[model samples]
Target: MLSLPATLTQDHARECLEQLTDGLQAEAAQVVVDAAELRQFDSSALAVLLALRRECARAGKHFAVQGLPQRLRDLATLYGIEGLLPAA
Candidate 1:
């Protein structure tokens, strides 16, 4: 499982995405990202999630996000990318 940090903003987006990408090599059909810890974040968090999902798809793995914060959900919805981040 890949866990999102509490504060995911532009400051940490690149590093966070890199960290999550490291887990994509796991030998599984589905990749699960836990987002319950996410609290202080911005739209950059959504971008990180989407990037992870894309990487998973390219690896022929299913991507799922767990415990996504409501704010992030609203952000996704606002950006019209909610469908891209499947709930786990």
Candidate 2:
């Protein structure tokens, strides 16, 4: 598992997505995403999580959001993917 630093939103999201996709293929299991430290986020950033889940499913590996912040939860709820992440 790796924690993504949210400072560089787009880059962080993309890098995390790539790592998840690549790691899942080799690991053959879900890679836990630690979003506890995330301070800020946006649509594109959240989409990476969605894309990761999809990619992991397509690759036959599970993926989950771990230690998500409440702020993120509300945003995800607004985006309709709230259930996808761990509760704050």
TM per candidate comes to: 0.96, 0.74
Where model 1 places Cα greater than 4 Å from the true spot, the runs are: none
Show model 2 residue runs off by greater than 4 Å.
Answer: 26-28, 86-88
Q: How accurate locally, in lDDT, is each candidate? A: 0.91, 0.69
Residue 78 displacement (Å), model 2:
0.9
Give the best candidate by lDDT: 1
Tens digit per residue, CA lDDT, model 2, 1-88: 7565655276576776777567565553756777877777766667877787787677776677777777767778898888775432
- Give the Cα error of residue 61 in candidate 2, in Å: 1.3
Residue pairs with backbone overlap in model 1: none
Q: lDDT of candidate 1 vs native?
A: 0.91
Model 1 per-residue lDDT at 24: 80
